[model samples]
Target: MYEMNVEDRGKLTSNRTFLVKNITKTMNVVDKLMEDGTITDDLKQDIEAKLTDNDKNRKLLDIIPRRGPKAFKAFLNALVKTDNAFSAEQLSPGAGAIYKVSMTSSEKGMVSPEEEKPQNQHSEIILPKKWPTEQDFVKDFIVKTCSHSEKGKLQSDNYYKMRSKPRGRVLMFNNFVAVAHKVEEEDGLWKEKLQMRDGTEKDEQSLRRLFEQLHFDVEVKKDRKVEQMRSDIAEEKAHRFHKDADCFILVFLSHGSTEGIYGTDGNVLTTDEVKSSLNNKNFGSMTNKPKLIFIQACCADTYDKGANVADNMAKDMSDARKSMSALNLNDPKLENVDEADSKVEKSPSDADMFIANATTQDNVSFRNTKFGSWFIQALVYIFRNYACQTDLLDMLTLVNKLVSEGRASDRDRNIAVAVSVFESTLRHKLHFFP
Candidate 1:
């Protein structure tokens, strides 16, 4: 039936330009599919129902740029809206159904085929009171994904329960390794400056308070060399190795770079080197456990307010893909070169590591004399309020919300947190016991 419809449609359109336009229109639907992350059996069926022929399908497939926020959104939209309203098999035991009413300007008509008429009986459509900015878009996207997930509540619970790990211990490392030295090496030059700014203490104090609230064993190390700090971490890891630890938390309050951390002696050591040293055979005894590392430091120098788009990494990937395409490279070479360029670290220390940088990739990690880094302050603040009762991501989302919608310098203090749990598949209620 699809083939016959395509054949008839093709006969009616002899104009190549019109055929090309038709093909482009069809491809737009495919692009939507790729955007929304919904490439499934039902997705294919819905798409097939929209297009009439193989030629149109081929044309549509060619226009998709491989990756983008739009494409990803389209992919996901296809997944939930196609077939039986929502995929029943994809829902978890306790999951409820999601029915989203996406509205378009009737005055302008629908922009895409995936956009269906709003089922709301009201004739006049009321636009959303506020247009969603990038941050709003990200939070909404995450919320939608979670709502659709099978183990949604449990996953959410595990994130919220930061201090409830029965098998793993939570260790909080507070205290910025102060930086004190007189310009490299000056013969007996003692510059006793307050290296860890007042801001640093606020973050440290808050972290300490959070743990104190949770009744977890907290360790505070101030004014330590690289080796000494590493040794302390090692000892703690070893102590917790045989003992039942629920989780391991390491918060570094100091000056940092993309490579590693800065010590009080003005010496820099790679975070990777420090973390690697804490592996199972080394200082880290809690192998395959959830390890969280929050680094309140700088990553890049570009702090353009306008550049705060959806996903910087995804944008970079898209740019790289375009660059590769423009180079006119062959299939094999493209695959190899692209693969090498896009390579990422698989695992960090066999422990679930969460690295939350103080700022975004190209933004500055702010420092206030009283509040510390905006990212850290926001993190601790949100965790203090919600960590025990809500999901970790939810808490982080709140942090993001607070930061994004906050003041001038503070707003720019964008944070980027990445986490990897060691697959325990368990949930806990994270709360301050005290």
Candidate 2:
């Protein structure tokens, strides 16, 4: 049945090319043998001879060490756990077949006969309804017959379980309160604050400590323009990752509005712009990879009004809306629009974007007089405590819960919050420490 046509066989002469071609062919052949039935010693010897014909093939053989009958059976059992075992089309589809094997160890005992079951079952117990319990009498004989017919016998039911492994690449991007803007305007004379009352050497130092512990390649930039921020993003995107990179994280702690963050000149830079700058042609492609962004910025539309006379009034959504409307009227010219909409308009469905906004559109993002930004503090705390033990989404959920429950003065009561998860299933829900 195995006839090689003269024209197709004539092309391969070089050892390297032949090695590659035959290795592929051998994989297909082995796949067919596995689907049809067990692989015998004679079949293994034949394949080994064909595979070892070239030096490159011989080296590949060493890399994928040849397994004996028991090992091969165990390997087959292992594959069932990882792949759709029953989906492979049987090579001898026309022939009558019996005694289907379960690939995974966990499912092995479930498929066994009544005699194979543990004797400690209760008197009221009935057999599983899938197959007839009367058929159990012939199972041992059938299994023994198959074992004698095939060279390889099935190993013990239990096999080693495959645990999750670590991916070695680390991603780190942190932005401190880097905006340098003119706050006081008197007769066109601009008064600048090099650092805001909340900003100082200690903020950046704390961030460096946290990120260093996380093993991030930290690079601190001061007072960057919007375009300079884009350039930094481009440079960071150039950091190469292996094919198995588990997760990526980017942290921005700056002065910002509902729609966008601020640059050095007080010009607004949108979140979509930041994300696009990292994904452009200048930056290396990161399609289908998990890209996490944590923003700690002031999303407040206007300065807070003094506490209401009735401090303990039960505020509903309507009250919240009224407060938001009043705030908007106070800052009509300064209200930022939907910056993320433009990107969505361009392409409705490009996944791998998860943005963690610091607050709801109406509320203000918080900054501490002593401790750095409130959102940043919550983030650092959660990442330090939970990032290693739980999934990123779960960890962030915990952060949001903690931040909302945190105590604050009436003047500074707006706590950190977040929303929006695009293509949730496609996300890599990994815990870096786990």
Candidate 3:
């Protein structure tokens, strides 16, 4: 390990505040540093002991300067490896280029030309390759998905028309707190106490920004009782603007069970009731338009113990089968309602609706107190980045892929994962085209 120079130490100290605020995925950085022998087990525990990401990052910055020469470089490498190359560049102007050269050259069985050059010859700095920002990622996907050939292949009549001045209205019900109540079940009587959903405001903000960017008139109702929620839904259904809109979207962020969502008063609002209220008979104006619903809450108390796949074919197959067996598909009763109408029959009331749940039945969805629910985070991110090029279904699929790969911890520190599920009845493709 090469010794970290005085200049690098100075840089780390001066940029402490910026690093603390921006270094997300802190555990990944800590793990890499530990693997590189830049930090001790004791130090790792101390860093993890801090409750928030900022505190953990502060601790990490404090410790690295004392870990000798290799610590600085190892920390920078970890940041770049964890999709934080922007931070690495901020710390050292050409740090990303240096790391990339080292990595790509190693794979090619050659030394980096930068490393081979004489010390004095490094006076001219090589500009690092531009790393994609969050907005850049969104733009790239839009450009790729809207290419001439890709757009040409789509049939005009196969997609829902989304060209309205304001595409539609979105109603979001964010229940951050629930009242305490005693309930009786078949098993026994139990007391239900719900805690405040911390960090939920962040999710509300994200959703508002996303929908507004997509040209939707967004309304958010927070901490409403069951009756209030029902009344709100009814008002939306009767709103005159629906006659000029292309679609409707509803979102629920609250504590819930397989039966339904919970209101701030601890009253249960059954999922069936929600669907029935938004059916063709009630929301007549949107009968043939798309109606989308997103629920971010736990379906049950169970945690998903994710499986690991091995390189060996036999072991991989065994893991795959075990995973398949563990999955429980909890399909809603209204999910299969037919959208096609014959001369002698009427289309189902639930036609053109798409329902998305954060997790499968009999599992709990994970949330970060500092960020938000894993499901919502992925949903906002994918929609923001891929909506221009991807249809609604494809965007939700990407959300599933992103959420399933995320690992979280329960109250007992057990490793838990989540998988998002969606059921769609729309006959045509739904695209935001934002």
Candidate 4:
């Protein structure tokens, strides 16, 4: 019946104005999809590769009267209006339906074979106030998916019950390791004094390769200033596709002070700024998802010169991640002041996010000019080797071990790097795909 209708429609004249209207509406749909991150950059590039074939297919498909893009728009419009427990053809008979709606628009002059001047019902048409954002879509999905899923038992009495795993994205980007060394004064008059970082390229390469293997869409930004860094990170969090990711990773590599990390221009940007930029509340779709941030830089310039140092070999804290649970803030305790501090970490008590600092507050984290930052080296190694078998916190602790005692026998200079969880909803153990 569908084919016969198509055959009959093929006999009709292809009206130029009607084709333009349909194409215009279709473009609107595609633009909205791209904004929602349903059609990603990578997905767009893939489709563009076969542009000629795609265009031809699009033109041919558009030949079918009252179908294609117009039909899709009408379907979404119906979803917006009704609260019906929607279902489509079962994906494979017994398998559950993948909520699809196939309906034709009631717009007049739909280039039909009948040549009937159909009465218009354009006045009754109701469009959505705003297109559903990707985050909006997923939160809705989570509510629906969880409603249908088999409920699982909670892990511990202290741990809150989670019927559904919080959804999120694995967002990774380098704020661009900037030049931190001092340059000679304008006309070579005064010698500028400073510490320097080298071989960060090693860190970048290792990260790009590692995430590629792990199947994350990674983007690297270099030479980002303070305001610029803040904007970009915020934009990423606000991106339409961000809500779909279950995990987020932010790796910071630059010179930092006891207060916070610095941008390429040597201006300090507080971790509080970072917190705001990456706040989970900003993304309704990612409210309970895990956001992992790894920062590697000197917390300060106070390098120890071996005076009041201990007379023993530095002990690598091999059991760091095990003790990590004793950190971070979030959904469980943030809003409830009475249970705060005691139930979770202090201050910025958001949820489902981890902040890893290379050095503790008010201390310097040593870096090697020859290899790379000690912290990043250990992080890449542990992630590449241990992520499959180890829990995330444990993996970070293992990284702390290698970085703290694992540095050259130069001096007992700095303390261990730390990873803090903020608003953590990590109710269960997670592992990277082997």
Candidate 5:
């Protein structure tokens, strides 16, 4: 095995104080170090537990020298990749100079000697070019799709009025950690534990930014129990802001079952309760206005083994026929047009509500610890790019397309895919006109 270089050790030791103070993205660096196999999960937890960035950095520095031979190099690379290049420079000036020169050359489209060298293509599976992060992908997608100038005017008759100063009030409930509890069954009391969601904060941040840009007043409630969530919803419903708002949006990011979303306390909050609480009868001010609910949670405990497009067409058609038959359109009750017209006169409490779940019924949603849920990522990206022009249903369709096309892997290396599902009772097209 290669030995740790004394020179690299010296660089880290010499600039320990400077690195501790200057490294801002310590978790990112920790993630990179862990990915490189330079640091173990235990060491990563130790670094993350330090409470402050400086403390985290100090913990990281303390661990690096004791790690394997490649640790120092990996740490430096981590710093550079995580936007702490200046700290990397302080640790090793020569490495910093090389990185800067490489970056500058890249910006100017001049390939370095190292990059010009041919690689053994047979040794690796070359993936298609992709953005380094979901954010970068979204930014690039938006720039390519949206024109800087406004393209068309929206007639009020065709679209919902979305011109209120603060177009809507958005309430987001993000539950990262589920509270462990015990279930008393016929056998005995069994402990139930849920894994903490790692990348949900990224989803929350993306959504907050997007909605704020869309001119909505946003409120985020983190790790709330069911009753607390209900209370917050009640308060939101009673808030006078709805008088001036054109729409309402509720977002839930949590672990869930087909029954409903889970609170931190492990208690379930059924989607029906959520809708009933905010229905037009309960929240009269929003009558006829759009009420959009976006849920990023697993609806069930199953994975989707996606089918080949060509082979699945016949099966899809058969399923469609079954579904249509189940609808019983031929029933004599369905032939009463006058009855339907009379029913339409009494507006349903759930009218104008749009509910979009991350995955279809009986399928688990996919979440990336590094990025976020595939559904929310695509939703934010598509909405940010197309909301200025596209209607809500069309935008959600794009979200469904983008998310379903994404692939995720489980611990067993099983490839899984997800498809977003939405149910809309929207009476008119809704556009943010951002």
Candidate 6:
């Protein structure tokens, strides 16, 4: 039922609010299903009237029960994707309530059944023996039905007969790296007009290229709010990708605090939120894969003095917008590249996960308005020259060495990087060799 109309949109603070709470106690979408398993006439009318490319939407009786209410919610979200990606078209799950090949569509966003792509025999997803909720299945349905090259009937399976070869994907969610200041007046008029993060553009650009060179399918997003960030790390797209990829690399470059990173809105988003988004328990297929979260933000509010003690560090989690110059590696002496071609046996159990922070909990780091932040530059340098030769930790060690030791032309501050190796499953060294 349309418990809350468009005019009531502002009062909504949660999905619960959207589905319940009319003074009349009238059944809302939240209580969409009555005891008899029938839906409100209002909702049924809404679904039926919404036609997709001249194809009538399937009857409501056919869409709901097969996947349950959560699948219906998934269908709601799918509609939004369709509206955004195509010209406001829609489709149903199918007439028979089957999970796959149920909907038929000619629109850019809706999938047709005959065109459905079969999943690879090796395709995988991490899940508990019993699902906690129907919503989770909805998310999985969306991911399983999509592919890299196409939308709607997108192929979830990408065959890889040679699973022994090193395989992985790098996902980049670096947004609002360069956000202008926003101000709301007493009258509530909002204004924005200034670039705050001068060097982050360079940081994102460099990382994207570096990962692509390493054969990682690089995906990037910029200037997202808190919900967008949360949806990203915890959603179907990212989770599904982990099923086949051997390693998952996340590079986040934005204003952050000791507690968590900041969304474009400047609110704190905790690191735990990030860890849960890619949790192994939730992602069974990724239990044995190496999950690396590379954070180029500050974990402390204090600054380090030149006395060379790490007790005091430098750099605000805020944007380091001093200079946009090219990266400069002091290049004292290069490490020997003898171990670049080595490989170790892969682990198939739940392990091999860690997080890399640019600074510890009490110190600050430095960034140049011209050359991006110090940590990101060091990361690019180490990966470009050493990933093929060194293991992941060793390369990160080099990253720590360079960032903590180098002096910036714009700011003369040095800080140590932090790494939390939550899991030690990498029995052998990692190589980005072809």
- Give the number of the best model, judged by lDDT: 3
Q: Between which residue pairs do clashes occur in model 2?
A: none
Task: State the lDDT of candidate 1 residue by residue for 1-434, as single tens digits.
Answer: 01223332333233233223222234344544645453444545555565566555544333222333244234324323332111211222111123234522331121222123222111221222211112121101101121223223444644433334332444544445465323533776556443544557656655654454343555667766678777777677667343456566776666554455566765555666655555533544555455666666544333434434566433332211110000000000001122455567433333344445555543444455544445665665455433334455455655655544322322323332221111112234332322
Model 2, position 188: C-alpha lDDT score: 78
> What's the TM-score of each model vs. the native?
0.45, 0.45, 0.59, 0.49, 0.62, 0.48
By TM-score, is 4 or 5 better?
Answer: 5
State each model's CA lDDT, in order.
Answer: 0.41, 0.40, 0.69, 0.44, 0.68, 0.46
Each candidate: RMSD:
24.5, 21.5, 14.2, 19.1, 13.8, 18.4
Among the numbered candidates, top TM-score falls to 5
Better of 1 and 3 by TM-score: 3
lDDT of 4 by residue, 1-434 (tens): 12324433442233222222222233333334455444445544444444454463254334323443333333233222222111110001111122222222332112122112121111221222211111111101001111111222234333222223323334443444453434577787644333334656556655654554444556767767778877878777777765556566777777776666667666767776676556555645556555677777655654433332564424432221221100011112235445534864433346666677766555566544544555665666556544443456777776666554422222342323432222234544544432
Worst 10 residues of 6 by lDDT: 326-335
Model 3 per-residue lDDT tens digits across residues 254-311: 8777677878887877878887777776688898889999988777677876775543
- Give the alpha carbon lDDT tens digit for every residue of 17-116 in model 5: 6577567668877887788688889988888888888788888888898886888878777766665654675576444435444344323232223222
Off by over 4 Å in 6: 1-166, 177-195, 236-239, 306-350, 408-428
By lDDT, the candidates rank as 3, 5, 6, 4, 1, 2
TM-score of 3: 0.59
**Tens-digit per-residue lDDT, 294-390, candidate 2:** 6655554444333444555333212221111110000112122456546443211234445676565545554554445444555555554344434
Poorest 10 consecutive residues of model 4 by lDDT? Answer: 139-148
Q: Report lDDT (Cα) of residue 78, candidate 6.
A: 37
Q: State model 1's lDDT.
A: 0.41
The parts of candidate 4 lying over 4 Å away from their true place are 1-196, 304-349, 409-425
Q: Over the full model, what C-alpha lDDT does candidate 5 score relative to the true structure?
A: 0.68
